[model samples]
Target: MSRRLEEILSNPEMQYLINNANNIENIQKYLPILSELAKKVKKHNTWFIEGLARCRVPYKDIEKYIDLDEILIDNCSIVGNIEIIRQLRNQKQDYQDYYVSSVIDIVCKTSEKTLEQTNKIEEYLTEKKYKYRFLPPDIYVIEFKSPNIKIPNQFGVYRYIDTEIEKQNLRIYFLIAAENNIIIRRNSIIEVVYIENFALFSLLFKFYRYTEKDKKDLEKYEKSREGLEKIIDKGFHEKDLEKIMKIFGKEERDKIMKKIKSYVDSHPDTIYKKLLELNIWFYRAY
Candidate 1:
């Protein structure tokens, strides 16, 4: 039993074991002997808050593989309600290390998607007997899989200096379990139609490999802007607009910029169209 517990403790993701104990007092009541497990960590490196998934681990052995300072996880949960817990580090070399967990609410997309193959993945994980015990109950639960996708190295997640705006990399995390807990683990990459990362050329390469685009729509318009913007009349942010205009020495490009701005001011939600409009000024993620 001690060997299993030690093995569980040595897991890289086990810093928040006891704190994730469904009910700390209740867990302690049943696990009266857990207190004597011997403190491995000089201080707390990871903060596991209540109602959040946590992996129980021996902080002593695994510190070599990971860094608590860089933050192993910001907040990882499988049961919906996306409030996340963060890892905290103390500056002192004294008092061993004590970590107290805290919670905060922030708005971010959880990559909610309706995927068909999702059930195939979830069902596979459930039947794998991957179950382990944190206390008596199962610690980790497979919430659901993200869309059936893989980040193709070629997805256009790049950009050049010619671009007016830096391309964004569409990064995401996968929820996973280890040592009987729903810890956030890097699983497969999120396969997206349009990548935000600045590797457009790479993505283009992948596009050819997948060359199985018999059914894939390439000419469809991309999702346009769904955001609000500052309204301007015949006048506008001349300096800012000028900066954009300077990118293209051609007057034709500047003329197109004006047309794009007019479209943006009117539609306010045609970001993709606006992007296309500024093809000269805008950059591709390469």
Candidate 2:
């Protein structure tokens, strides 16, 4: 096997996905496409290529195999649950990088956790290499409101503490891409997860390692997998796209366009999938 192919398939999570085939048809349907991608476009996008392997079947490829929304709506037991799942799936339409939802949504829906609190929240954020910015208790009042720390020209969050009341005391604000500013006075933010120009697929490798030794214990393995499915469903954020644009580094239009064209030419199917799904033209300005 080619080294790239070997690298992609050697992943224990990918192997588990293959072994736990919901049906032979899912495997028969998407494996060849993944194989072709592993063999052909391996060099251009190691991150995404590996992601394809981690996901086993990218989102669109899963559609080629099964209609997940329809299956849930048809087969689910409760009416309220079906609506909730439908809404959840709709919210995740743009972020559906892979076929994870269909396989794991059942496990997710049964959990008592809210949509925001997926199990092992800290672990996944850690895998993404997020830098946690914890403010001192009076951080917002002293920083943003009072100007103690000079804010950098980058993305970050700032807040103010309202000691006037016992509850609802924190007021949160954010600087997006170091320019667009926002403030949230009502809702409390548990924490901020931030990673710079990070590839979404990298999480899969970490997830794989987390689940590698649990094959003998089916329940633990499936629970971990369910948590991962929640993370995947959150998908890549709009801010992440801005970060992704920096992949090739900043340069003149002609140079950037050339690199993008080369990428699109070399990885037609993958690029096409991204363009169609995300409505992003990574090749050129126009």
Candidate 3:
């Protein structure tokens, strides 16, 4: 068995909980063990939580351990236990955090429609309250948090931006996760969408073929290839290119720009298609 499965089974209490998930008496007897498993085996804790929900354990009992958003999303199905669903709905309504509330709203609303298809998720995004954009397959939402916020243990790519509002700078971040959820924090965000699991070599080859040019100059700046690819993926913004130039120095910047301009001039159609792809991936987050 896989190490993760073994770890779950190794804990006899956890194993009992999973086995008797539909038994409310058993869940209540080992309730404290659920919290311990949540802390110890975080990656697989969802299984235990799902069991609790399925068995109709009180939401308040599980709320202290598992995240509300996680439980709601993981078990947001009409087939899911109705009492647990009602408890989660009440909990969601009581949340004052805008991001959390909005996320719950999106998931609950979309789940009402259908959770089995991507197109169904896209269909209900027309609501004015939360303007969610439809991301293509393999593209994911990346959330950012302002530095002033005291959110701890947050993880993602980090980028800094300068703003004139109050003469203070903000440290923006890009939170990449395995879900297609939108997370907004106090109206401060940098960029939202990125190519999921981007393959550098494959993108480079596509770039070369699109430009219909030799790879000599591209290979010359081996160190800058990744940076260049990022710029292109983000739709060849001048500011992004300038940032790359600032990091790699002016000479390398000029060469990179020259190569890109040559490609744009030579293959306008190809470049336009790329920009369209970017537009479809990125939407205004409000």
Every model's TM-score = 0.17, 0.19, 0.17
What are the RMSD figures for all models against the true structure?
23.7, 23.4, 22.5
The candidate, 1 or 2, that scores higher on TM-score is 2
Candidate 3 Cα lDDT to native:
0.29
lDDT on C-alpha atoms for all candidate structures: 0.25, 0.29, 0.29
lDDT for each residue of candidate 1 in 1-286, tens digit (9 for 90 to 100)? 3354455454543324433432122222322223222222112122222333333222222222223223223222221111100111122222122221111111111212211122322343245322222122222221212222111111111110110111221111222221111122223222112111112212122222333331121111111112111111112233434433343345545444555454446555553243443353333211
At residue 275, give the lDDT of candidate 3.
33
Report the C-alpha displacement of residue 184, candidate 1, in angstroms.
7.1
Q: Which stretches of candidate 1 lie over 4 Å from their true place?
A: 1-211, 220-286
Give the alpha carbon lDDT tens digit for every residue of 1-286 in model 2: 3465455455664454334322121232344434443343333322211111121324444443334344332112212112223233444453244223222222121112211122232233345343333223222210122212211111122221111111322221111111112111212111122332122223322222324332222122223333334434555656555543443233432343443344446546422222222224333334
Q: What does candidate 2 score on TM?
A: 0.19
Error of 1 at 262 (Å): 34
Q: What is the lDDT of residue 94 in candidate 3?
A: 30
